[model samples]
Target chain A: MRATTIHGPFDMRVEDVPDPVVQEATDAVVRVLRACICGSDLWAYRGESARQPGQRIGHEFLGVVEETGSDVSGFRPGDLVVAPFVWSDGSCEYCREGLHTSCPRGGFWGSVGSDGGQGEAVRVPFADGTLVRLPADAVSDDRLLTALLALSDVMGTGHHAALGAGVAPGTTVAVVGDGAVGLCGVLAARRLGAERIIALGRHRARTDIARAFGATDVVAERGEAAEAAVRELTGGQGAHAVIEAVGTEQSMRTAVAITRDGGAIGYVGVPHGSGTGLDLSTMFDRNIALHGGVAPVRAYIPELLTDVLDGTIDPSPVFDLTVGLDSVPYGYEAMDGRTALKVLVKP
Target chain B: MRATTIHGPFDMRVEDVPDPVVQEATDAVVRVLRACICGSDLWAYRGESARQPGQRIGHEFLGVVEETGSDVSGFRPGDLVVAPFVWSDGSCEYCREGLHTSCPRGGFWGSVGSDGGQGEAVRVPFADGTLVRLPADAVSDDRLLTALLALSDVMGTGHHAALGAGVAPGTTVAVVGDGAVGLCGVLAARRLGAERIIALGRHRARTDIARAFGATDVVAERGEAAEAAVRELTGGQGAHAVIEAVGTEQSMRTAVAITRDGGAIGYVGVPHGSGTGLDLSTMFDRNIALHGGVAPVRAYIPELLTDVLDGTIDPSPVFDLTVGLDSVPYGYEAMDGRTALKVLVKP
Candidate 1:
C-alpha cells in the first residue's frame, strides 16, 4: 500500500507501507478512495508545528470497508463510508451528548499510534461509532463523491461554527476566513436562513467562491479595516453572529470587535502562534458569547450527508485541485503555496 | 445634603455636600431611601483599587423621586424607584437590545461626572432609561425594601450568571464564590429550575446561606481539589453549567475545569488583578462556552421584581447587618473584615 508521510519541514512523500489489518473486535480495515491535506497539516509543512521524520499525516478521508471485526455490527465489507477525523466509542457520556470530539475513549487519526487517513488502506477502530454510510447508488457520481468527502471534516466543521455562533433566520453574519471551512461556514449560514452574510478575505479566487457560496458582501481588508467594513455594512451596529475560521490573535480580535453586544463568536480554527488571550473586562462589558472548539464531525455527518445526497448543497468546489496517490507531495505544496483552496487525492 | 466620601484608603466619612439639582433635561433628583456597600466597593476601601482622597463612593440604591426636569416625564415626585448601577439613554442600539450597560450614552454612577447613590439626594441622568418603578403598595415593608435594593446590583448580577450559563430545568450547576452575588446565583439557579446546585465556598456562614438559597452540595476545596469534588459529585462527568462570581484566575480556571464538554460558564464578577487568560487549546478541545459580563440589571429588573413582590424569593436575608448613614465607614470595615455578609445603610 502507498501512504503519505512527512520526513521533515517541507518534506512530503508517498512511499510503500504495509496494509492495515483488523486487529480488535471493534476494528475494521478500509480501502481509501479519497483523502486531502488540511489547513492544520500545513502548520507542520511550513515548520510552524513540530513533526518527526516518517510521521503519518492526514485525518480526512472517505473509503470502502474492506474488512470488519466481529463487534462491528452497523457496517460490513464493500460499503462506502465517510469517517470523521476522530474515532470514539458511541456509548460514552460525551458521545451520547453529541460531543464525540471530547469522548473519553476517542483519539485523532494520524496521531502518535494511529494510522493516517492519506493512505491506500488503514485500520479504523470503533468502526460503527466513527463511520457514516453512504447510499449505494450515490458513490457512482464523481461530483457527489467530492461533496461526500467534504462531510468527513471541513463541511461538518463549518456547520459547527454556524451552529455554535447561533446563526439563525433574519440575522447578519460575518465569516472571518476564506479557507474551505470558512466558505462552508457561509454555505451553512445561508442554509440556516441568515439575512445577510459577509466574507472577510483578500484573495480574488477565494472571495469569488465565497460569493457563490452565499456571501452577500466581501471585505478584502485586514484587521481594524475589516472590522470597520463589517460595522459599516451592518448599519454601524456590527454583525449579530461571527464565524472565526482562522485561529490567530488578530482574527479572534476582529471577530470579537465586529460582533454586536450580546452577539456570539463561533471559532473553529486550530489555535496557532501566540495563544488566544481574552480581555475578561471587554467580554463581560458586552456580554459576548464565545463558543467553538474541534467540531464533532461524527455527530453532524449524518445530517450533512443527507443534504449532500439530496443535492441541496455542493461543496466540491472547495477541492480546486486533485491528484493521484503518488502526487500527494504536490498536493501539499499546492495548498501551502496558496495556489489551491484544497487538494483532493485519489488512492 | 450629606454623602459618603472616601478621604483615603481605610478612611470613609459622611460629610456635608451640595444638594443635587436636576441639571439636564433628562435628569431627575432622587432622595436616597437606602444604600448598601457593595462587594466591589470593598476593593477600594481596602486600598486594593486606586481612588482619589475624596470621592463619592456608592452605586447601589433605591430612592424616592424628589424632583424631575421638564424632559423627564415617566417619573414623578415621591415615586419610589430602583436604578441600575449604570445610567443610559435608553434609546441607543445597545439599549434597544437590552444591553443598557453598553449603551453609547451611558456612564457608571460614582464616576467623576456622576453623583454616587449614597448621598442624601443624587441626580440621575436619563431617568426613564435608568430607573424602574416599584409597586407603590410594596414599598412600606423593610424586608421588601432590602430585597428591592438587591435588584440594583448583586441579585441581578447573580441572575445574569445563571442566565448566561444557560441554566434551565434538569441541569446541574456549580457556583464558584460565596459572596452576595454567588449566593444570589444559587437562588437564581434554583429559581430557574436547575436540578442540582454545588457551591464552592469555605466560610461556614456563607455556606449556610448557600444551602438556604438552594445549593444541594458544598465543596470547601479550592483550585484543582474543588474541580475534583465537582467531578466526583457528577459521577466524573462535571456540571452542566458553572457560574463564576469571583473574578480571579484560579476561580475562572476551576469553573472551566468543572464544566462538562459542551457546557457553559457564566461569569459576572468584575475582573480584578491580572485579566483572565484562557488556554485556547484546552477550551477548544473541550468545546466549553464562556458567556457573561456585567449584568444587564435593567433588562431583568421587572421579572425579578415580580418574583420579590409575590414572595417567591426573599433576597433581603443577605443583608446581615444594618447601619445609619453616618456609620457607612464602619459598614465598609465590617464587610472588609468579613464580619458581615452585607450591610444595609439608611440615609
Candidate 2:
C-alpha cells in the first residue's frame, strides 16, 4: 500500500508500506477513501516541530471498513465511516464527559504503533468508540463526502471553538485567522445563531470564503488595527465571543483584547513560538474566560456529520485543491505556499 | 478624620487625615464602621508590591452614609451601606453586563485621587453604583456588620470563584487555599450545593474553620501531592471544579492538575511571581477551562447580602481578630505573621 511519510523538513514522499491489519480485539482496518493535509502537519514540514525521518503523518480521513476484530460489534466490513483524529475508548470518564482528546486510553493517529490516516489502509484502535458510521448512499455523494471528511477534524475543531467561547443566539462573535479552522469557526458561529460574525483576515481568497462561511463582516487588518476593527464593529465594546484559531502570541493577545468584559476567548490553535503566557492582570481585570484546547473531534463528529448530510453546511469548499495519493507532496506544497486554503487527497 | 496609611513596607500607621468631602455630583462621603486587612494588601506591606509613603491602604469596608452629593440619589445620610472594592459609574456597557470591575470610568479605591475605604470618612465616587444600602438595623448588629464587610471583597471573590468554575449541585469542588477567600469558597461551594468540598490546607485553625464552612474533606498537602490527593478523592478523575485562591505558579499548576478534564479552574489570586503562565499544552490537551479574575463584587453583593440578612450564612467568623483604628498596624502584623486568619478594624 502507498502511504505518506516525512523524511525531513520540507521532505514528503509516497512510498510503499505494508497494509494495516486488525491486531487488537477492539480494532478495525479502514481503507482510506479521502485524507487531508492539516495545517498542524506544516509545523514539522517547516522544521518547527521535530519529526523522525520516515515518520507516518496525517490524522484526518474518511474511509470504508475493510476488516474488523471480533470485539468490534458496532462496525463491520464494507461500512463507510469517519474516524476522529484521536481514537479513544468511549466508556472512559473523559470520553463520557465528551472530552475524547483527554481520554485515558486514547492516542493520536501516527503515534507509535498506530497507523496514520494518510495511507491506503490503517488500523483503528477502539473502533466502536472512534469511528462513526455513515449511511450507505451517503458515500456516493461527492459533496457530502468532502464535508464528512472535514467533520473528522477541521469542522469539529471550529465547532469546539464556538462552543468553548459560549457562542449562542444573538451573541456577536469575532473569528481571528483566515485559515481553514478560522473560516470554519465563522461557519460554526453562524450555525450556533450568533447575531454577528466578524472574520479578521488579510487574504482575499480566504476572506472570500470566510464571507461565504457566514462572516457578517471581514476586517483585513492585523494586530491593533484588527482589534480596533472588531471593537468598532461591536459598538466599541468588542464581541461577546472571540475565536482564536491562530495560536501565536500576537493572535492570542488580540483575541483577549477584542473580547468583551465577561465574554470568552476560545483558542484552538496549537500554540507556536513562545509558551502560552496570558496577561493575567488584563484577564483578571476584565474577567475574561479563556477556554479551549485540542478539539474533542470524536465528541462533535456525529452532530457535524448530521449537518453535512442534510446539506445545512458545506465545509467541503475549505478543500480548495485536490490531488491523488501519489501527489500528496503537491497537496502539502499548495497549502504551504498559500495557494490552497486546504488540500484534499483521494486515495 | 483618621485613616490607615502605609509609610513603607511593614510601616502601617493610624494617622490624622483630612476629612473626605463630596466633590462630584455623583459622589458620597461614607463614615467607615468596619475595615478589614485583606491578604492582597499584605503584598505591598511585604514589599512584594510597590507602595508609596503615606499612601492610604484599605479597600474593603462597611459603613454608614455620612453625606451625598446632589446627584447621589440611591444613598442617603445615616443609611448603612457596603461599598465594593472598586467603584464604577453603573452605566458603562461592562457595568450593564455585570462586570462593574471593568467599567471604563471605574477605579480602585486608594488609587491616586480616590479616598481609601480604611478612613473614618471617605469620599466614594459613583455612589449610586458603588454603595449597596442595607437596612439601618445592620449597623447595630456587629455580626451582620462583619459579614457585610466580607461582601466588599473576600466573600464576593470566593463566590466569583465558584461561579467561574461552574459549581452546582452534584459537582465536587477543591479550594486551593486556606485564607479567608478560600474558606469563603468552601462556604460558597456548599451554598451552591456542591456535593463534596475539599479544602486544601495544613493549618489546624484554618482547617477547623474550613470544616465549619462545609469542607467535606481537608487535604494537607501542597504542590503535586495536593493534586494527587484531590485526584484520589475523586476516584483518580480529579474534582469537577478547582478554586485557585493563591496566585503562585505552584498553586495555579496544582489547580489545573486537580481539575478533571473539561473542568474549570477559577483563580482570583493577585498574580505576584512571574506573569500567570499556564502549561497551555496541558490545558489544551485536557480541555481545561481557565476562568476568573478580580471578583465583580458589586454584581454579587445583592444576592450575597440576602444570604447574610436572612441568617442563612454568617461569614463574620472569617474575621477571627478585631482591633480598633489605633491598632491598625497590629492588625497588619497579625495577618502578616499568620497569627490571625483575618483582621477586622473598627474606625
Residue A141 in candidate 1, Cα distance off native in Å: 1.4
Off by over 4 Å in 2: A274-277, B274-277
Judged by DockQ cut-offs, the docking class of candidate 1 is medium
lDDT of 1 by residue, B1-347 (tens): 99998877899989998899999999999999989999989888878778787789899999899899899989999899999898889988788888998888898888875678777878999999999999776668888999999999988999999998889999999999899999999999999999999999999999999999999999999888998999999999788889989888778888888998888989887777314445667779899888888988988899999999898877887899999999898999999999999999999
Worst 10 residues of 1 chain B by lDDT: B273-282
Per-residue C-alpha lDDT of model 2 across residues A1-347, encoded as one tens digit per residue? 99999889999999998888879999999999999999988988898888788888999998999999999999999999999999999998778978899888899887766778888988999999999998988778888889889998999999999999999999999998789999999999999999999999989989889989999899988888988888999889888899989888888888988998889999899888323436777888788889999999999987888888888888988998999989999889988999999999898
State in Å the error of residue A170, model 1.
Answer: 1.1
lDDT of 1 by residue, A1-347 (tens): 88988898999988887788999999999899888888888988888888878888889998899999999999999999989999998888789989999888899888876789888987999998888898876678898888999998899999999998889999999999899999999999998899999999999999999999899999999988898999999888788889989888778888888988888988898887314435556777888888888999999988888888888888999999999989989988899899999999898
TM-score of chain B of 1: 0.97
RMSD after Cα superposition, model 1:
1.8
Residue-wise C-alpha lDDT for candidate 2, range B1-347, written one tens digit per residue? 88888888899988998889989999999998999899999998998888778889899988888899999889899999899999999988778878899888898887766678777878999999889988898778888889889999999999999998889999999999899999999899999999999999999999998999999999998888888888899999888898989888778878888988889998888886424447777888788888999999999999999998998777888999999998989988999999999999898
**DockQ of all predictions against the true structure, Cα-based:** 0.71, 0.75
> Would you estimate the TM-scores of all the predictions?
0.97, 0.97
Going through the candidates in order, the fraction of native interface contacts each one reproduces equals 0.86, 0.88
